[model samples]
Target: MTDDVRNIVLGVIAAGVSATLGWFTRSYLWRRRLRRKQAFFGLPENSECLLVVNRDPGTDGAVHRHDVFALLELSSIVKDCSAHVQILSHDVGRQGYGEHAEFCVGGPGSNRRTAAHLATLLPGVRINTDPEPGEDRAAFQLGSDRYRLETGVAEYVLLARLTGSQDSRPVFLFCGQRAIANQAATRYLARNHEKLARRHRTHSFVLLLKVVNSQAYGPDVVEVIGDVTRTAQTPPPAPDPETD
Candidate 1:
């Protein structure tokens, strides 16, 4: 080949290589920054967090499969945060939640730990259940807005991110009026973690998510009702150990 032609070919190849490397580097850094933003709890390197699942009291400690599926999704994001995660049932989680960050799944009816904590901390939100057997009615009341099970009406899940002055570890509550709503809340968090983290970087926040057509679309149709973080008043005093 002529010297001029050879020189042109080498220059083209070097430019292509350089472009590829630049693209790769930018992509890598962008993903790294995203992962950092998704680290909601901000646990230090190798620290542990708890995933508390619910078990049906009517059954022999059998967990709902949908809830486990949601946990798996959350686990992946938690893993990316450089934290060790341990899964536990609500019964066990009731013992302690002081040192480690906690992710409590399921609503008050299914997870008593979630119930106790919600009752103690979040006064504005209440989970109500039917006392009569064979009733399929459940509701989550946040302030004056009530999301109850009714024909053609929407249901909701309450997703709360909280931190206490006494305890540095944050507590995440994922509670739905129904099982589908519970799963939807988790999926929503996973899908929008970066946006959520940026919005709620340090302060605590509460989200009310509406699950449209939950009977049909399940978690796929979930949407945010509102960001009630500012309205979520300071957590009430911890219950007395003897009374609790």
Candidate 2:
């Protein structure tokens, strides 16, 4: 072949190699994250971890793409934490829609097992699947403390649950849009603080972090460790008397 043709062939080969190498690196990093998360949380095979990603209605495609990257980052964390993984999504009616990715370590009854594991990881934290009167599902509270956390299909809600409460915790909300994350955080605090206080009245604070696009929100977008406030109080009444 002529010199120019030979150089063109070499260039194409180099490009192909670079693309393959990039894909491999990404895959390796993702697996590492999954392992990290699993080990950090000590999630068993039956245990599952849920990640809620909030997105704007006008930019569903962008949100989805962003989550795909977030998932990879989360996967590395899960691997590091020694946990399993799954992916799900949620849409806030009239507001917007988002995605949810879950990591399951074990088999059937994983929810219960995962909850138990979480309790151990989150010391002094009261965990429950049921909601009290006017409470939301996917909610958990610190024992006798005002701190509460609620999870929806698309987002996670944190509340202080007391009078004059403010968001003091450095919480992170991973999403493609800042506005959507802020909105979700505001709604969660507005809707559930009172109810959370009734159940565990104490000094509590909630933080919201939104992950803007996967490229922007990297592996360190949401850290597992953070500060939280604790308080003592009586348990609130059940949401349904019949169920009790």
Candidate 3:
């Protein structure tokens, strides 16, 4: 081949090779991200997932506004992984935990499904649904530490990924002291799922999150209090004999 022709052909071949490598790299990265999300969420690609809803008490078929936002955020996540979202209200919801990936939202005060999860899965955690006068209602008691609610100033919520002993699917729990806190938890999950996946890939965990300035930020301002996985999952210590 002529010198100029050979040079042109070699340059074209190099460009083709570079393009092929770039496409492969992009494909690999996309697949990796998808896998990590699937693991974090316990929902395989193109699977049927359940969204257990918690309706507000004393309301006739009405969902809290913040809870609705929370569900919408979670729905985007489910959509990202190509999973179908089938919603069931806490009143009539009946299904096995491990059969499909599930996301349960709202606190026990309104969500009996969440109450059941705390009862069966998280034995150490206790939520005060009702309190007499001069006491803080909707407080959380995990072991000895008590998280009190203060309206818009401060609120606490729980986000947990729980898997049954014999089941591989994980059920995500979003229990909050208030409706806004529940939305905050879901926002945190949506933003930090990749980081969470890296640390606890497919493993169960529980987190305590604080919502700050909800009156101003509307679930946008949040901070992590700590990981309550160990304390929440473990049963509380028996009453001390000395105290008794």
Candidate 4:
């Protein structure tokens, strides 16, 4: 073969090798970022994160069965992260959460800390308990979209993530009018976190999920009903400059 042709062939092969390596590097970095993002919720290795839940006084301070089941599933999900998990009730959560990432389980009526944090962080999304006449469930008013829990067949839950400032730690909220629905919400987050993270880049969003045949399958089946993050941005009560 002529020297000119040989040199051209070598150049082409080198360019192809370089392009292949660049693509692999980009793919690796993207996957790593996703793992880190998903790990922030008490899933990262050596992460010091808290898992907050509410206890029913009627049940003698015992965690509800649904909450317990959700916790178990969460444990498995983050097992690889080897997160240092600390379980606390909403009562103490107000003072307990520091700079560490956290998972708040249950709704406002049930978990006080979750209510207060969400109110301060996401004031636009209000959880309303006033059931419609002849109806048995509550609704969430986000911007113009009013998300209500379906009666009989489907129930709804709210899964929210929050980070106010650049230095602020992340907080994940799993809530519903009923304990079972809360379980379904957490399960939904665990199952579809990748899609949620991709769609909502703000790192803060609310998901309205519908539980399917929860009575039969528990929280195993869930569907995303709505994404209220954009609408839920009701200008978080002008942050107290003093606190800032």
Model 2 alpha-carbon miss at residue 107, Å: 30
The TM-scores, one per candidate, come to 0.80, 0.28, 0.93, 0.73
Better lDDT candidate (1, 2): 1
Q: Write the per-residue lDDT of candidate 4 for residues 129-226, one digit (tens) a residue.
A: 55344353467666656666664457778788888665556788887767788878877776776676667654667777788877677777887777
Query: How well does model 1 score by local distance difference test?
Result: 0.76
**How far is each candidate from the true structure, as Cα RMSD in Å?**
5.1, 16.3, 2.1, 7.7
Instruction: Assess each prediction's global lDDT (C-alpha) against the native.
Output: 0.76, 0.36, 0.90, 0.73
- Please write out the lDDT profile of model 2 over residues 17-125, one tens digit for every residue: 9999999999999886555433323344445455434333345324434334444554564454445554543321122111212321210111232333233222344
Q: Which ten residues in a row have the lowest lDDT in candidate 1?
A: 128-137
Best by TM-score: 3
TM-score of predicted structure 4: 0.73
Residue 152 of model 2 has an lDDT of 22
* Candidate with the larger TM-score of 1 and 3: 3
Instruction: Put down candidate 3 lDDT per residue, 1-244, tens digits, no spaces.
Output: 9999999999999999999999999999999899889867877888988898998875886999999999999999999998898999997786668888989999998988899999899999999988353456898999889999988989999999999864568889999998899999999999999889888877889999999988888899998999999999999878778853
Q: What is the Å distance of residue 109 in model 3 from its true position?
A: 0.6
lDDT of 1 at 9: 100
Q: Candidate 4: misplaced stretches above 4 Å?
A: 1-34, 37-43, 96-98, 129-137, 150-152, 235-244
